[model samples]
Target: MGRTIFLLISVVLVAYYVYIPLPDAIEEPWTIGRKAAIVKIGTDLASFGELLGISHFMETMQLLMKFQEVPPTSDENVTVMETNFNSIPVRIYIPKRKSMTRRRGLFYIHGGGWCLGSAALLTYDTLSRWTAHKLDAVVVSTDYGLAPKHHFPRQFEDVYRSLRWFLQEDVLEKYGVDPKRVGVSGDSSGGNLAAAVTQQLIQDPDVKIKLKVQALIYPALQALDTNVPSYQEGSHFPMLTRSLMVRFWSEYFTTDQGLEKAMLLNEHVPMESSHLLQFVNWSSLLPERYKKSHIYKNPTPGSSELAQKYPGFIDVKACPLLANDNILRQLPLTYIITCQYDVLRDDGLMYVKRLQNVGVHVTHHHIEDGFHGAFAFPGLRLSERMQNQYLSWLIKNL
Candidate 1:
C-alpha cells in the first residue's frame, strides 16, 4: 500500500509539472517593447474559468495562498500611526531613524486595479515601510474603498480627501517630515490616483503644496485606447492585462450602468476635441520615435444612443494623459518606472513624453527583464532580481 501511494504521488507530480502547462508566451528578455503582449495574456488568463465574477474572492484567495511569501519583517525603527479620512482608514509609516534631521513625505496609494487593494495588503505594507526606512521618509498609505462597491469618483475622492487632510493637518510634523519636500507615489491604479492628485493640486488655489517629486510605477494613466501597441503586444502577461483592466473599470462604474456601451464604442472621448489632438501630436506629447511602431486606425463609430448614455467614458478626468497642456505644465519633477512585460507601458511612455513636452523634469526607468506586479512580489524566490532592482531604484532616487 505504501509503495502504491508513493507511485501515485510521483505520477501526480509529473502530471502537474509536464501536462498542466505553465503560463506560456511569457516574453523572453522582458522589456518595455513587449508590454502589450504580456498584459493581454495576463488579462485573458485572469478572465478564464468564470473568474471575472469572483475577482474579489479570487484576489483574497491569492493573498491567503501567499502566506509563505509574507513572512514578518522587522520594522523596529518604524512607527505606524493610523488615521481617518472622511471615515476611511489611513496608515502612516514613520521611520525612527536617529541620524535623520529632516525627511521627505510620501503619500502612497496602493495598486490593486482600484477595485481590490487595501493598505493592509501585506506586500503594500512591506513596501511602504521599506520605502520609509530606505529613504528616511514618512510614508502614508491610504486604505481607499474598492470598486463595484465604492465606484469611480469615490476612490478618487477618498484619495484626494486623504491628501488634503495630510496637508491641512500638518500630519507630516507627527512623522518628523518637512512639508515642502512632500511627494506622491503609487503602483498601477494607485499610480493613476497619484498622477491625478498631482494634476488636481496643480489647479487648486487653497493647496499651495509644491510636490518635489512624483514616483509612478506601472501607472494606469490612460483609458482612451487600450489598442495601443503595448496593449496589443503584452495583453497576456501573467499578472495584468487589458481585459482585466477593462473589467476593473467596469466594476468601478457598476453604478453607472451604461459603461459597457461607452467602452465598446470608444465614444468616451470626443473626436474633434483638442484633447484628442494633443494625444496624436507627435512633436509635442508623443515623439516620432516612440510612434514608430504605432498603427493608428479610425475607430468604428458607436450608436448615438450609446454615446449619449456613456459620456463619462471619454472624459479627460478618466484618462489623465488626455488632460490639457495647462495642467501638464504644472507637474513637478517626475520619476516613472515601466515594466516591459506589463500592458500599461505605453501609457507611461506617452505620459512621459507629454511631461517632457511641457518642459517638466522627468526621470524614466524601463525594467527590461521585469513583469507587472514584480515589485510587490519581492518575497517570491523567482522575483528577487526584479524586486532588488526596484528597491535599489527607490532608495537611490527617493
Candidate 2:
C-alpha cells in the first residue's frame, strides 16, 4: 500500500508540474534541499489519503499537515484547555505555575490559507505551549471559520468575536492576565486576521483592553500586487508557489471566474483602483535591497468587470496594504517576521515600509535563509531560532 501510494503521488506531481510549467524565471533559477522535504510531506499526505480511499480529503490533509506542528508532551509547567468565545472555538494554553502578578496575554490564529490548518493541531499546540512557557503568558488560538464553506467576513468576524471575548469577558482578570499588555499574533492567513483584528480593536471606542501590539509571520496582506519582488523571487520557491497562492485566494473569496490567472499576471487591479496603486505598487515604494536584480513591471490594465465583481479585493480591511494613511497611523507598534525564500516576503516588507512611514514603531527581522512555512517544522534549528527571536521580542514588548 505504501509503495502504491508513492507511485500514485509521483504520477500526479509529475503531471501537474509538466502540464503547467512555471516561467523559466521562476522555475530554473535556484535550488534548495528543503524544498524536497515540503513536497514530500505534502504529496505523501495526499497519497496516503487517496490510497485509503477516504471520502473526506480535507480532514485527511488537516491531519497530515498537523504532523508538522510541535509535538505536545508532558510539559508539567504548562496546561492546555479547550474553550469557546461565543460561537467560535478556541484552544487555550496556560502555564502551570502560579504567577506573582498578572501575566501577559496573546491570542493567536493559525494559518492554512484560510482553507486548512487548525489552532488545536499539534503543530499549533506545540507553538502555543512553547509561547506560554517561554513568555510566562497565557495563549489563545482560534479555529476561525474556513473558506468556501463558512465564507468571507465569517473568519474575520470569528476572530473579532474571540478577541472581544478576551476583553469583555474579563478573561484577563480571571486568568490574572495583564489588562494593558495583551496582543495578537498569527502565521500566514492568521497573521492577516491578526492585523485586521488589531485595526478593529484600535477603532472600537468601547474596547476594554488596549491592544498594545501585533506580530505577523510572513503574512498574506494583499492580493492586488502579484509582481512584487518576493512574489516573483519566491514564485518558484518551495511550498508556496504563485499559482497555489491564487488557488488559496480563490477559495477564500470565491472570486469571479478567470480572476486568479489575471491576479498572477499583475493585471488584476481594477481601473477604479488606479489611484491607489502609487501607494502599494511595489516598484515605486520598495527599497533597492528588496528589488534585487529583477526588473519591476507596470500593471497592465485588467477588466473593470473584475473590479466591479470583487471590489472587496481593494478594500483596506481585506487587503491591509491598501489601507489609507490615517488607518496606518493608528496601528500599534508591530513586529513582522520575513523569510528570504518566501513569496509573501515582500508583503511583509511592504507593510513594514507603510508602518514606518506613518511613524508606527516597527521592528522587522528577515531570516537570511528561510522558506515559507519553515517554522511549521519544529525539529529544524532555524525554525527553533525563528520562534525564539519572535518570542523574545513579543515577551519583551508585552
Candidate 3:
C-alpha cells in the first residue's frame, strides 16, 4: 500500500511538470536557464496546489514570490523607514545627504499583478534606496494589500491614499521633499496604478502639488485586445505568460476565475462600450515596425452577460490606455519602457502614440532584447541597465 501511494505521488508530480513545459523561445538569453527554470517551477507548484484543491493558484503563487523577500538592512547612503500613511503601509527611503535645499521626491510602486510583491521585497526596497541615494531624492514605496483577498479599487485606493498623504504640505516639509518636483513611477500592475493615479491627479482640485514626470517600465496598460502583436509573439514566454497575466487581471477585480478564459478571448468589454475599442485599436495605432506580419482582427462584440458579471474588466481604472484625450494631454513628461519579448510591449507603444498625438512630451524606450519583469531580477546586467535608464531620466527631469 505504501509503495502504491509513493508511486501515485510520483506519477502526479511527473504529470504536473509535464503539463507546464518551458517555452523553447526564450528571448532573454542572458539568464534563460535560471529564468525558465524558476518560472516553470513556480507555475507548476502553484498549478499543482490548485489541482489538489489545497489553495487557489493566485495565493500559492503569491506565497512563493513573497518567500524570496529579504528583510531590510542598514544602508550607508540611505536611511530606510517602514511606516504607514493613511493606514496604507509604506517604506520611505531618505538619502543621507545634508542638502541646503529640498530634494526631489518619487512615489515608487512595486508590481506583481496586484496580488503579489510588496515594498518590503528586496527588489523594490533596493530600487527605492538607490533612487534616493543616487538621485539624492526621497522615495516612498507603497505596500498596498494584495488582491483575491482585498479585490479591486482597494489596491488603487491604498496607493491613492498613500500618495495623498505623501503629497500633503506637512509631510513634504517634514521629509524635505520638493513638492513641485515630485514624480511617480512603477512596474507592471504598479505601472497601471501609477498611470491611473497620475490621470486622476490631473483633475484633482484639492491637491495643489503637480507631478513632474512618470516612468512606466513595461507596464500592462490594457485589458482589451490581448490579440496585439506582442501578445501573439511573446505570450508563451516564461516569467509572465499571457494566461498568468489575464488571470491576474481577472483576480484583481473579482473572485471569479471563470472570467479569465473569456477575458483572454477579448469578450470582457461590454457591447455598449464597443466605441472605446477605437482608442485601443492597435492595428491603427501601432507603428509599422510593431505590426510586423500579423493581421489585425477587430475583437468580437463584447458579451453583455460577461460585462454585467464582471464590469471592472472594461473600467478605465483597469486600463489607463482608455483614458480620454484631454486627460492624456495634461499628463506630465512621461518615460515609458517597452520590451520586445513582453506581452505588454504594444500597450506601451500604443500609449506613446496616444500621448504624442495629444502633444504630451514622451520619452519612449523600446528594448528589443528585454522581457516582462526585467527589472525584477536585480544584479543582472539587463536589470541594471533598465534601472539606470530609469534613474537617468529622473535625474534629468526632476
Candidate 4:
C-alpha cells in the first residue's frame, strides 16, 4: 500500500508538469511542433530529451539531421572540387540535359548563423543539386570557415576571395556558363553573405564581373535591432530564438570583449557616425502594416560601464545591413524569401524596402505557413509540403 501511494504521487507530478503552459512567445503551434520534433529526435539519439536544448550548437545539429532522406535526381550531375581561395572547399552541380548554349551559374552559400554549418550539409547539397536540375543552371556551393575561431572579417573575406577566384579561373567559360547569367544565392546566414558579396562586387571599381541577380532566403540582413516585430513574436521559435541569436553574434565577433560591445551595438560602430541612422529609421523601413502587432518600445540605454567592457558589437561588418546607401544602391536585382513564422522574417522585409527605396529591383515572397528552418527538411514526411513550396518558389524565381 505504501509503494502504491508513492507511485500515484509520482504520476500526478509528471501529469502536472506535462500540462503546464509554455511561455507566451513559445506558444505558437508551429513552435510547439518544432520543439517536439527536436525533442523526439534527441530522445531517439541519446535517450534524453534534455539534449535537445535550443543553443546554437544543438540547433545546428538538429537542422543538419532534420531531412534524413534526399532522393537523388538523375538530371543533375555533381562534382567536388578544391578551389584556390585559401584552399576553400567547393561543390559544383550542373544540369545533365544536353544543350549547345551556355547556362546560368549560381554560387550557393549554406546558412548556420556563421558558426556551425558547411556546404556539404545534406540539406544544402540536395537543394543545390535540385536547383541545378530544376533551373538548368550550374550551382557552386562554397564551404566558408566558421566563426568563434575564425570570426568576423574572416568569414566575409573567405567568401569574397572564393568569388574572386571563381571569376579569375574563367569558371564561366570552363563550365559552359554565360558570364552575363552569373548570380549568387543563399538562405539565412548564407543570404546575408550573398547580399554582402553582391554589394562588395558592385562597389569594386576594378572588377568587371557582372551579376544577374541575388536570391536571399530568410536572410538575417541586419543585426542593428533585436526588437523587430518578427524577433519579438517568434523569439522562441525552435532552431532559432532571440537569446541564441545574441549568442551567435557574440561568437562571430570573436573576442571576450566583443560580447559587451555587441549588446550595446557599439563594438565597431562609433556612436557619432552617421551610419547609426540606418537602424533608427523605424517608420520608413518597417511597414506600419507589419508593425501592427508589435509594441514599439525604446531601447533601454546601456550602462556606461558595460559599454566600455565590450566594443566589438558596433562594427558595421558584423551587421552588413547597417552598410551605407552608397553600397546598398549597388546591389543587383534581388529575390528575397520571408517566412511568416520566422524570427528573421522582418530582417528580409526591411531589406526589401531599403533596396526598393534605393531603386534596386526586388522580388519578394512571403511564406505564411512556414516556420524557421522549414527548408532544411524538404524530404521529411511531415514537412514535405512546406519544403516543396519553398523550393518551388526558388525554382520559379531562379
- Leading candidate by TM-score: 3
lDDT of 1 by residue, 326-353 (tens): 8898888888888776778778888888
Tell me which of candidates 1 and 3 scores higher on lDDT: 3
Order of models, best lDDT first:
3, 2, 1, 4
Off by over 4 Å in 4: 1-36, 39-86, 255-270, 273-277, 301-313, 380-398
Evaluated with lDDT, which candidate comes out highest?
3
| Residue range 264-383, candidate 2, lDDT tens digits | 677878776777776677876677888778786668878898777766667666677878888889988799998888888888888999899999999999887777787765466778
Give me the displacement of residue 268 in model 3, in angstroms: 2.2
Residue 85 of candidate 3: its Cα lDDT? Answer: 95
Candidate 4 C-alpha lDDT tens digits along 65-164? 5554333334426543434444777777877778689887888888887876676666777777777876778888887878656777778778887876
Measured on C-alpha atoms, candidate 2 has an lDDT of 0.78
Candidate 3: where are CA atoms >4 Å away? 1-30
User: Residue 1 of candidate 2: its Cα lDDT?
Assistant: 100
Q: Assess candidate 4 and give its lDDT.
A: 0.67
RMSD of each: 5.7, 5.2, 3.1, 5.4
TM-scores of the candidates are 0.78, 0.85, 0.93, 0.78
Judged by whole-model lDDT over C-alpha atoms, candidate 3 comes out at 0.85
Candidate lDDT (C-alpha), each: 0.68, 0.78, 0.85, 0.67
In terms of lDDT, the poorest run of 10 residues in model 3 is: 19-28
**Candidate 4 Cα RMSD after full superposition onto the native fold (Å):** 5.4
Q: On a 0 to 100 scale, what is the lDDT of residue 144 in model 4? A: 84
The residue-level lDDT of candidate 1 at 384 comes to: 55
User: Comparing 1 and 3 by TM-score, which wins?
Assistant: 3
